[model samples]
Target: MKKLLLIGFMLFQYMSFAQEHAWVYLTDKENVATSIANPISILTQNAIERKATHSIPIDERDVPVNENYISQLKVQTGITVMAKSKWFNAVYVIGLETDNISVLADLDFVASIDFADKSLNSESRVALSNNKFEIEESLIDFEYGSALNQVEMIGVDHLHVSDYTGEGIVIAVLDAGFPNVNTMDAFQRLRDNDDLLGGYDFVDRNDDVFEFTGNEHGTRVLSDMAGFIQDEFVGTAPDASYYLFRTEDSAGEMPVEESYWVEAAERADSLGVHIINSSLGYRVFENENYSYTPSDMDGNTAFITKGANIANEKGILVVNSAGNSGGNEWQIVGAPADASGVFSIGAVDFEGNYAPFSSQGNASQPTQKPDVVARGAAAAVVNSSNVIINNSGTSFSSPIMAGAIASLWQALPDATNEEIKQFVRMSASQFNTPDFFLGFGIPNFELALEIGLSLAEEEFVRFKVFPNPVSNILNIQIPTSAEPTNLKIYNVLGKLVLEKNIIQSETKLDLSLMASGVYMMSFESNKGSKTFKLIKS
Candidate 1:
């Protein structure tokens, strides 16, 4: 009887301390003196460069949260700060039982106080396990070893042969944690060449992401893109640079992780990342009331989805994993995947059939989700121990598709993110008849490049140049149907080297004086103008 009484007392104590988390929304950035006029003061130089290239403006959203307001909130003894979102103009905090959170609503800076966790019941706060999906390892023999099937399935090798290996692209990977990426032999090339730019641990509020002892899910996801072992395994975008961020906490499931993801994405945008690959998704939360239903899967709903859309507007191609809930009762693609602008990926087998575990798109949503499918079942990956292995999940598929997209973007550096996405969709096998399981089917990089080139030709006047690597003379050929136009040749730096009038369909120019390098040729006809890359040998 005494033991039962003690148990009851402990339960009561537990309930007393389990107060709900809340977000204090500030009315405005009033107290903050930071100005939006000078984005360089807040954003990095790379970030500035991206904005300049993409013609994206430095707006009010780019400014940091008011430090004075946050500092004042920190002074409160009973509140523990969780995360701050500059995008939402809000700060998430956890209050103790003795704290009077209602008093915060009276503060001049405070807009409103809302509970982060809607459900306060202890039983509804149980953490969800991460072992819902099982990985199946398969052994395959090919010239490229473990990576051969996956890369070849998507035709990324063709881009590699054309020397489009995502050399200058920057990709930011947001995941649970990278356990052994720093020391793994498979990533030796990336480390030696400084391709691994840097990373941060948002959960711990530290910069030591490499040393963090967390799950290997991130390591596996990264392996599909950057891992390389000479003649053993070659990732899709082996030359692309990367920023690793730990946004998800593997030990627990909660809405706070969504805030962490948004924070990481904002950091990525500020770092001028060209692409973001997020394999994490949110659906069920520890607090049942915070969980999303199928109807909430609409693109505009969840916080992460909204954040992803904002990231897309900033010119970063966001690739996310369609949740792996197909076999379960709540079988539908989760949050950010439902977000319109994101390039969500699904899982497929080697035979081009949808993986049973791959989640389908939300039927109610108008947009066909899981933008495309990749070889996720028994997908090749290098483990944390530097050994090549096979794993299965949309997580692996998302990175595989992301790397290929990067390589494709490298081939068409002048194309906008939307153009690239459209070309990729057009190159899919089932583009015209997209289904829920595999939206546009598998994408072919070779075909995507061809489609992009064709679209460019249509947008601009079509012309041909010969003896591209010419040593003495270069030949220009305009279609007989085309009108005579002025032809100009510029160096890679956009400096005009020569200009001539093309009166006839066939024209020749002496180039013996030019040095050996790459150049751009532009033909300005009455109809339109076109520019093509030229090689001078």
Candidate 2:
């Protein structure tokens, strides 16, 4: 009796601190208009017929609601499912134990599920290997490709790649199976740069994710992050390090696969990985009954997603694919990718226009999904076999952005994840006014890094705005040695809140009637125009 009581007490403590998770809803098959445009719809209806849709919580607000759905959802699946989100055509759910999700699949109504475990498989992707360097050299078509040689070849206007590469940062790529990675010439760069950190094959539970054919997912992704650049195609972060972990199996999308992902994430975290780039997402699976509802978009649903969120909290920046099939029945984005802390990258063309195939979202429940966009259309990357192939999907876009993010982290070591995220969002081409299609818009890598560093430096300056979260009287205590050139403030709506030119040592402004929220302040010192985030209480 005493032992049982202690165990129960421990369970209670865990429940108290543990985060909530649920399966949530995406879209009902009944609601989907058609899928000739969306061949994926067949998968959804299959799930619905299998009671997979019923396995997901029913729409509480629907005309003929399944009154037993909510209670049964909690009792049967042991998770919470909230209301549906029209913006993303999904529902929100919250739960505790993210692992051992097989119990859900065993349920009569359930089809597929995700682990709710918060453990992450995150770690540094920087491991020096002869093979990694070789891939880098071979991809660039260089007799010998050094970091410097690759940099000189890329054709971007102003890429801050050197500062990042010189620092030697690592980025982990989590995706489907990678075939023939060992023999791939494209991987020589990863080997040469000493950036190919080891990874796990969660798909097959083996060390190799490339044992299968037709799955170049991992190979293409890793190449984008640390691929060697020649004339026409250049990766965003060619000099950075890389780690490859395969979480998806070639068979199809499923809950077991996500369990594998969670396990992988935990391993990554244990290795001290700095960043995780996951290009896999799930809405509908082979077991249609397990298709995700919008409510399941919360970070707490799948263990892998929970792990992804934890990765961010631990200072590891997490990036995920927004999902393809934009012009489909399940028009919203998919799970684990929808986790709040993770920065989901959407697909865009070279022109930075939103790709129609890019998944749409205001997130499943709330907050922004696909926090930013990157070039995904016709993304060029070297396959393991030394062949150059251009692929299209949010999957490719995610890794491209991940490379850029790794570069930024190398440049700004002291910066926090929030600082990095906000800086990237604010410096984007379409910032302030975000939408379902494009959250904050496309990030400018160089500009974002500059903004982040400037803010960190400025924070140390005498610019102390006392009573932050203030109702009025915003005071700026300027640094004695700094010269004030032009100061501007933009409201959350991107409206110019206030602007002034001052050469004085101190600055003060009054905001008696502005609605309270978050604001952006740009202070132009002779040095540079620095941007900072302000929250109004």
Candidate 3:
């Protein structure tokens, strides 16, 4: 009788203290049309210009979250607002696992509830953790020194030689604490140039990002892109401007960090950031019940992944690190990396070999992940102490690749974000044959530049190909020309599969007889020869 009484008492106590983490989705915004009418009020002038250049519409997603709804939730008992996202029109809230919080669902403006702990609600959980960024461990006119291998591996050196070093480009680095970036000698150049545009600590809700006492993961990640130390070192995009944002809480592994990331990304978009490099990934968490399975790696799932796609749609190039779980149980790329719009990056050694620790992509997913590879094994980086060190993980590779992309974008300023991604993918070494490990393999920036320049020409711009990665029929919209054009399709092994003569502006090729694989379609004429990557589904 005493044992039963003790058990009943313990159950009551457990229920009293249990806290829940969830996202409280709002029904509608109070003023979407008003905000869209005056975009400059919410977004920076530079951001407005970027959207104009890309022809992206300023829709309701660009509107800020309604403050009144947040105010109402803030006044409620047993509820604490954590973060809010303008893209999803939702607010992250933490509260006691009791009737008070659950009553939020009954509110008229509340759309629904998504609990981080699946047991609290009917929905399954997504991934959240910082274990991936833990690593064992640049520049221009520039001795790359220890950073030479990584920069040259992706042909960033060639872009630097052409004087395309990310000048006028803005990048936002989102990760954990950036302890000494404000004082690091390696970043002194960035500070002196005044390229260090301010940032915010979303985790602590402060303006300071370099004052934390946790891990220096952000410092290391930033060094790969913005660090400069004269002849001793030069980051890939030393000339590029930066905004340092701390979104990860290294002290604890919680699902709220994902909401923190979305908030940061929304801020980045408003600031007109041209590129966003996230050297962090999510998978397992402290509470196994909040973990996501391998199948959940689909791009359409995960709150952060959805936010990433929205970031891409807003014309910001989102670059993320493929997690370091290749040899572990969670071997697939995690969360935002699985996001189709995200350019997920993987790790390679100095010799251009795949790093065993680099995360692989899901075979079932149609979109190839880890879009490309770079030197991550023994990659050179600057730490919080302002010292160069060797580290291994996709964490390092992502920044290396992102910095190169910034430089590439600088060279091709007029190119759209989608065009830039296609240029990089087409220039990859394994564009004709990608796998789960390296995706399209290491890219060649020099080759990508060449392709971009060629395609940018007025005559070449008229050449359009529809439905890339087709199943049965491929359509080509040939540019009008007096000279007769010839077409050739080749397999991965460089063996010719089909040849045809073009007689009109539009032509269709029946590929149903061909086996499923990647192909290179070449259009040759008196003007020149242009090749495009083709995939068979």
Candidate 4:
């Protein structure tokens, strides 16, 4: 009986050590001498340039975690460091026994330790399979034959024709795995031009992303943005530089992937990636206890969602896929998709109809989700074998939209990321009346360009009209280079009250004869036309 009791105790101790995946939160970066005021010491030159261009200030969160703390923890026996997050000031470690946790917590620099997984060996939660629709491949032509339809559907072809094919933009794609991206002919131009900057596989904690034997979901998703095959196909942003990050583990669904995603995002930000395209969403997990119900779809509830928001705050545009759970019993968009400031994309057919499998937004959230829809249903993509094929999912749509956004930014380099998002939303077909399924509807890149150009003109011209409530004369001041070619004043009833042709920098309008109310003064020039509200007394 005594021998049996000792054996049972030993087995219990072993079991306790077996389930030891926890996060060690460091108290501070004390050992590191780098100060947050000097971001150049931590961030790359490109990252500094990006922040300067966007007027984003460097904060303490941008600094790397204390290397001394990490090294000390690594030296401890029976502990294996998994991943590190500078944003959270924490490191995920496994194999930490109860005694080690107590001792580590007692360290001066150790703030806290939380078990990532409280229970193990729970019932396996079923993974949600992607609802992909297979379609026959179309005949490839010499001029974006199959790919043209997708780009033209969202009016991105206009930007491409205008020489804004996302040149000088850097985008980071985070997904399951990119199997044959290194050898795929469709990505040859990206490789040849050195646009494929770098990549890392967070799951294995290595940089060998191309050598993975996981799903080809990332390959197909990337083809929507970077793939090019002469005239046969042209991606949305073929000239944009890319960073590929493998953050998803195809074999399992767990919260640890979220931590991996945060780590990859921090890396992307450090590398100065302008945009991040994430085709993965989380709601269900391998452990049922870790699975999130629809109520947790609130943007702030999930760990990944919080990280995505922080990435946006760092001046990086995040585009995510609205999960394809429309027909499932738990039908709703997943966590990161509901994240605020994220450009969530939904799936739609070529006919501009919502795809049945496209997840809907949570009704409880005030903000309409799925900022826009794109040609995700039967979307064209290049597989790992370098063959063009058709598949269906929002995974294809998010990148499609992200590439277009990159092109838009390329065209309007002076525009802020927030302004670009606003323009895209305003240019959508249903901006005034958005719904949960396809919020604001499909975006028209052509319209967005017009708006951007108009805004630019306003900034450049700096034209102003003053003397609102003027009893006699109203003065108009125009920039010397942009003298008004014509001017017109209209009443609220759309009746033209006055018209004149001006070739001078200053024009005086006699408003004494006009009745007191709201009127509009129109100014037309070679650059563009603008209208301003005039208040008369």
Best by lDDT: 3
The better-scoring model by TM-score among 3 and 4 is 3
What is residue 122's positional error in candidate 1, in angstroms?
A: 19
Name the candidate, 1 or 4, with the larger TM-score value: 1
Worst 10 residues of 3 by lDDT: 135-144
What ranking emerges by lDDT with the best candidate at the front? Answer: 3, 1, 4, 2
TM-score of 4: 0.79
Residue 521 error for model 4, in Å? 17
RMSD of 1: 10.6
Better of 1 and 2 by TM-score: 1
What candidate 2 gets wrong by more than 4 Å, as runs, is 1-157, 229-233, 298-300, 458-474, 477-520, 523-529, 533-537
Kindly list the per-residue Cα lDDT of model 1 for residues 155-225, writing each as its tens digit: 99999999988889999999988988999999999999899999999998998887656577888899999
Q: Which sequence of candidate numbers ranks them by TM-score, best first? A: 3, 1, 4, 2
lDDT of 3 at 26: 92
Let me know the TM-score candidate 2 reaches against the reference structure: 0.63
Residue pairs in candidate 3 whose N, alpha carbon or C atoms collide under 3 angstroms? 137-390, 137-391, 138-234, 138-235, 139-234
Compose the digit string of candidate 2's lDDT tens values, residues 39-81: 2333333323322211322222112223344455656444555
Compose the digit string of candidate 3's lDDT tens values, residues 1-537.
999999998886565337777889999987778888989988999999999999889998888888999999998888989999999999998787546578999889899988777767776755544364657743212234878888988999999999999999999999998988999899999999999999999999999898955788899999999988877777899999999898998877777888999999999999999999999877766666667778878887678988999999999999999989887777889888998889999999999999999999877654788788999888888888877878888998999999999999999999877668878877889976888899899999999998878766544465777677798888888777456789878664334678899978888888889998767677889888897667788
Worst 10 residues of 1 by lDDT: 120-129
